[model samples]
Target: MKLPRSIRVIERGWLSANNIVLEERSEAVVVDSGYVAHAPQTLALLERALAGKKLARLVNTHCHSDHMGGNAAIQKKFGCAISIPQGEAPAIDNWDEQQLILAVADQRAQAFSYDDTFRDGDVLQMGGLDWQVIAAPGHDTHAVMFHSPEARVLISGDALWENGFGVVFPQLFGRETALAETRATLEAVGRLDVDVVIPGHGPPFGDAGAALERAFHRLEGYEQDIARLARHCAKVMLSFSLLEKRSMPLAELPAYVARVPILAELNSRYLRMTHAAMAEWLVNELERAGAAGRREGLLLARGE
Candidate 1:
């Protein structure tokens, strides 16, 4: 997996978004700060990657907690200017937990301020390479992807993964345009002359066309049955919580699901199961998927 000499990809596990450090001359730019729980690790990686150079800027593709949770810590450490997608600017400025999806999902991310915001079609010069910011509104309505023409590389933030795109999150929020936007976003990516794609959660891959085909296939299934997508979202949220908490008492799991707003919404809209039932189902599903296991009286996250 040889990447351009100027950019370094720090592939964080599923709990944290990958961080891309772009170095040019004496300054550095970091994209996506990862989850707050891993802020210290993110900083250590940056320190090693940036060496003695100054971190000049930090940019986020979306307001997702896994991607932007370390903003405050990084800002405090480097005094770097922060840039975020324009659509999430107001949420960040107001520090409204309810407005941000992180809060809705019951995820934790320390509030932080942004120095500026970039809109779709914006061009950024980082690591002496020109990258264009393009709107990607499926996984996140305000998400953006960065494309470098010379390198034929794209930083696809949760928009297009090697296996499939992220969950159509807007659909869960009662937005009907989500499927259409996702289809359009995929088409837009298809039009780009990309040789490599750096996805938000996976390792960089070179087969953009094949990945698109996979994404389209997944989209077709989701379009046909949104219940499937909602189920996936439920599992993902539970998996993420497990990844963060490691384990929880079996008895407490029900109340836990009931507490998260997004989990409750998923239950009410699609699953329609009681919180206890949802929690039990989630645990069973996780165990079935080998993502979790039961030990004694506790449900333990897998591979922990």
Candidate 2:
């Protein structure tokens, strides 16, 4: 990887977001602590990487549980100052799990406080490099990406990935302009002179141009039929659920889907199928796509 000598990448699997640790002399910055389920692992990685120095600050590209779920554990451990997108400060301050998508999807995140907020065009300095904060609003309305012109590096938080980007939650909630926002975000990323991209999920990739091309092509395909986009979101949520729970009894899948407000809402708006039908369809789709498999009336999330 062409990363700074001071930066270390912690590659996490699907359920937990990747963590980037940038150490500079007396200061250390950790970005996007993984899911709470993996907090212990995250802490271990940070401890080994930091050696004995305390973590100075924590930054979240967005407030998604996978991205910031480890915040409480990390903050408690290091007493680090936290920074997050300015738009989500209200929901964080109020601890609205519902608004945070925690209650709706039954996702978990321990509450943590942020001491500072960043907006689009703001500059953040870490590891002796200045990163420009760029707004990226489709995936999560308040998401942002950090770009280091000096290093030709872009920390793309769900805006652009090696394969595809994150699910556009805003679109499933009837925000028609969300897809357009995603397109705009992609365009903004395309305009950057990037050499390496540190994505929110997968490992860092070198060919930024190729990734942007793939992302734009997928964006165009989704634009043709919004329902197709909705179906993608449903599968993503289902896969995430499967990732969380290694396996679930066949009979419980529908009830499980029905219990998740966000999944049910997506089905109501797009799939429009009953819980049983939707469950079967989602599972079938996953199996067909080779992302999951059914064994003895139980669904297992396939390892990627």
* Candidate that scores best on lDDT: 1
Question: For each predicted model, how many residue pairs clash, with residues at least 3 apart or on different chains?
Answer: 0, 0
lDDT of each: 0.89, 0.88
> Which residue pairs overlap in candidate 1's backbone?
none
Cα TM-score of candidate 1: 0.96
Angstrom error at residue 37, model 1: 0.5
> Model 1, residue 243: what's the lDDT?
90
> Taking the tens digit of each residue's C-alpha lDDT, what string does model 2 give over 83-127?
999988998999988767787876888899899999999999877
RMSD of each: 1.3, 1.4
Error of 2 at 83 (Å): 0.5
